[model samples]
Target: MARTPTASAGRRSRTKTVLMGGVYVALLGLVSLIIAVAVATAYLPSYGELTKRSDLGQMIRVRAANGAVLVSLGPSFGEWLPYAEIPAEMRAAMIAVEDKRFRSHLGVDPIGIARSVKVRVDSGRWRQGGSTITQQLARNIFLTNSRTFGRKVKEIILALAIERKFSKNQILELYLNRVYFGGGAYGIDAASRRFFGHSADHLSLGEAAIIAGLVKAPSNYAPTADAEASRQRSGVVLNSMVENGFISAAAAAAVDPAEIRIQQTTRENSVRYFTDWALPQLDTLIDETSDPIDVWTTLNPGMQAAADRAIDAHTPRGVQGALVAIDRDGAVRALVGGKDYVDSIYNRATQAERQPGSAFKLFVYLTALESGMKPTDTIVDSPVTIDGWTPRNATRTHLGPVTLREAFSRSINTVSAKIGAQLGFSTIADMARRFGITSQLSTFPSMVLGTSEVRLIDMTRAFASVANRGVAVTPYGIRKVITADGRLLYQHEQNEERVLVAPWVAAEMVDLLQSAVMGGTGSAAQIGRPVAGKTGTTSSNKDGWFIGFSSGLTTGVWMGRDDARAVGNLQGGTAPARAFSAFMRVAVANRPVEQFETQVPIPDWQLTPEEQMFGDVAIDGNVLESMVDEDGMPLDQPGQPPVDQPFLQPGRPGDPSQQELDQAFPPQQAPPRANQYPQRPPPQQDPRSQPPANPSDPGAQLP
Candidate 1:
């Protein structure tokens, strides 16, 4: 009886305990519901407001340097599709590649997440994303790119909030707008235009597929950066389109893989040479702007094309060259740094420091002229050493005596050196500085040979001074920058500075340079019209240069190996002159021909009796010489009767000084008797040496 009573008590106690636990569980469940409701109610409204206030549709504006809109920064961060202008194929393609359940999912799709997780585990990598359209939108708007547990929690909260506040269409729009595409583009619209040079609405099925394919790895699939990778990814997108029923299997099969014309956007303002030179100037002009300002430079498209073509045609592949072309007023028209702008952005024309070679002699001559040294002054062209530095002419032999005009025309190194030494290196260096050569000029005597390095733009500007009639004009690219509302933000004016050389002196210099093209070192630069220029070839043939000006423009061209190695046998007259000629041919085609002004009239100064006998006279700012022929070739061959004519005797002159003048200006010597030409039947010696029997013979015409 006692045992029975105990068992009953135990059963009763167990029942009571069970009841108490149920009550406690019910109370705890009620509290959990209350806490969940409170948290949702507190955060849902703020999340809803965020989804409702998404500004993903705002347009981004991209303007030309001249205020013309090249393209607008499209809405959706970088999503740039014109409103309601996206094509059906593009939309279908996006949905096919990114989220097949885009339309059916509310904010989160449980089945999609499960499948994505399965795929990730099977692949042994997180290659698949389970985010629905709502999740993607939520992350883009409110979540950081943090893979932390807290960020994931916040992402889920934002996704739920977005689902409660916005419709499916709105979420899709936000998602598309906020997605990141590579190449500094944010949205599909910009990506489409940046990759294909067209709008989203204009994309073909293949193009749409390619763009949609980029979402997985934008940089990796960027067609400009990696065409093969992008093409392969496009195949994946095409396959997905077929698998997702967006495109028929037959349609996918019929699509030709090679027919996908992946056009790259041509960056019009990306001329590396000109842009490199113009960047610093742009910084100065827009230095005050908080944002980088677009610069619509005064670059002439035609001239720029010519410059690019010239450099490409002249420079060897992998070798670098730089060219600059400017209007007479100092407006930069065109610039080309290397063969291709995309290959490298370093602008050789504006940034490279190179030896100017004999091309810089123009400054020396101009300075001398400015300092009252007439172009006609007689100077000895004999071998001269300055402080153990012996400067020789390009031709190993000296001309004994020649006028300043002839020396300069021939690019005589020795004569140029003598002139520099006579005028003082500081004077020439100062003159170069005034012309805008900012590079440090070496104090050595070799500096007169353009041993100092200078940028192509600075040299071009210095030459422009001569073309601008001694008025130095600072070169500029940007004309103006303005706000979207036409508020003038920045403007550039013609900055001019009058240095030392007079307009007349510049004019005279121009005339003297014309001789260079007519029959001198720069004869290769002759177009059908009159041109004034100088050719420069450095020692060991490192840099080849030609800088010249026409009546309306001034241009500079440089050709050399990027590695600073010798360019074989290349000379300035070959590549640089050819480039200059080709560019000028196009640049001056439509302009009226204007002759360089002959500022100084020809002088009728009397020649002394000795000067007359030696055929030397001061005329037209240069000493006149009759010893050298019209082609600037010498008249006599030493130790032999002057080839075609009798040599003028030394002492049969009106004045005794005539002998001295003849000796000073004697002609070059022929080879020694032992090395004389094969002895032939000596022609019958005629008193007059009556010109060779063949009057029509070209050699007989030699002086």
Candidate 2:
């Protein structure tokens, strides 16, 4: 139907007005959205958050005594590179693989997010990441990698804020410099140098591709772990680059991933053991300082290598071994904790506690020596029971009468027990404590047999005192600790104390120990340099130990199964002695030969109160001389050990005649120079007499 011109014009005018009004409302809504975005961006964390410098993990450099880098632990970025310094190909590869529209997109990519959401919905899991490089950098710096919706919101806000605050080049530089690589390496510089042995500026196309691929999963695609997997990942990155038009197809195809040589920074297995032991020592001297620390250790690389070889060559399968070498000054030169550090990190040398067996007899004899008993004194090796605990000699034969030196050399258990009983368990314990054994000791008769367990390190340090002329020594490893800025934090100094009252006692001990290596159980340990040591074997052969020293060094070796099972006839003289010999040969190859210093004779006041009692009761020199047998055994004493139990002469089974007995106990013309009572000096409150010597002299009478 036709309408009048005025009515049609009116309806058309109303339609036009409605259309114009709708356009005005849409424009207002758009302005409001822009204002809201501007407000949110303004309220976001200040721009300084994106520009502030953050501290990356510091690098810890451990060096050997010779200035060789033993290990580099923690995160260390090789060098920081500006955006222009990074190779263009590296940037292209990272952008193509990590974010295709990195240059054009705001921090949050809507198209990528839509794609990721569709894929996640289809696969029923969050498989694909929709964030751009800016988002990743934001998360890495200010947020954790949690998959919660709140974290996603925070990431999107921070990414958009970063886009508003930082330039594209600045954002890219931060991303490249902060990304993590495998093997404790962080940033492109570190990744490039670690994988290709070249700086980031010199990275080849193929090398750049391999490093870029590690961003997805550093440990999984690390070149050191699986070169083929890393190569395949690099191929994917190269294809992405080509598809994104960042590189030509021909150029991408020309590069071969197989030719990329991964330069792996491998720490020496032996050096790692040393570092592990030394790292904890730093804390005692220095507290938590943000700066990096330099710890110089006393480990001798040559000696460490020698010790490693010795343990590997001598240790039986399923058996663990520990060795520690200490120099004359108590410096730990070499320490091998176990057969291998990789198989287990349990440091047996410093941690494990096992019976030292006869190695503990050194303390008992020292106590006896301090009590004025000479090494020439006779002690019956016949079997004796203490509290129903009978200890037989390892050889299973008793020498009816033997010199104290002979008893020690043979490692006679009965003689050691008798001597320990004579000194009283508490006295012996005090002696051991002074020598550096901190573990609790059992006071039973078996205590003399090392019934108490002790760490290998402590036992070795204890023996070092004997080597150092009676000065107690504490084992130390760290030589000095300095910060990166040249501040001295700690400097280890040798600590020595006079644990033994009489320095000459150490000399007498040296004599007896030398005899053991010369003709006794430790004969196999002789290294042709006047060596002295002891052999220790538990009853069931569960533990075998050899601790010995030359004039230059003292070493201890222990071998046994971890489960405490017997290893077929393993003795201290077998593998342990051989290992000691093998290691010492290399340890002292170029050093000058030195002899043990003569120990100053013990003074009279150093004797125990009981020993002084004898000095006070003066008797005729001839009578005192007659009282002791030729072998130095006190004769006709009250409570003398029974002699009729058993007797085995050298060439006969039955008891010998009086002539044989006389021959066995020959009269001593003079006591050992070390056994003589010192001549009394001018009287004081408690002045000691002269040193003991010249037993045949009338002044050498026993107390």
Q: Least accurate stretch of 10 residues (summed lDDT) in model 1?
A: 686-695
Tell me the deviation in Å of residue 398 in model 2.
2.6
Q: Which candidate is the best by TM-score?
A: 2
| Model 2 TM-score (2 dp) | 0.69
Candidate lDDT values, in order: 0.69, 0.78
C-alpha lDDT (0 to 100) for residue 703 of candidate 2 = 18
Cα RMSD, each candidate: 16.5, 13.0
Q: Model 1 scores what on Cα lDDT?
A: 0.69
Encode model 1's per-residue lDDT on 246-296: one tens digit a residue.
889887777665677665432444454554555456456554543223445
List the lowest-lDDT window of 10 residues for candidate 2.
Answer: 613-622
For model 2, residues 1-703, the per-residue Cα lDDT tens digits are: 8899999999999999999999989999667655655665677555445433335656676667775545668765566678899999999989999999999998889999999999999999898889899999888887899899988977877787778877898889888888887866677886876677678997888988998899999999998778899999999999999999989999999998878887754336666766777788777877777665667888888898899999989887778999999987778889898987777888888888998998999888887786767777888999888778898888799889998899999899999888866667666776787677888888788898888898888889878888877676777788887765578988886542444435677877877888888899998887767789999888799999999998669999999987889988788988898898899888887777777654454344544444432332221112256455798654553333233334345447566766877676653354435433322234352221222223344432221
| Clash pairs detected, candidate 2 | 614-703, 630-666, 670-696, 671-695, 673-693, 678-690
TM-scores vs. true structure, each candidate: 0.68, 0.69
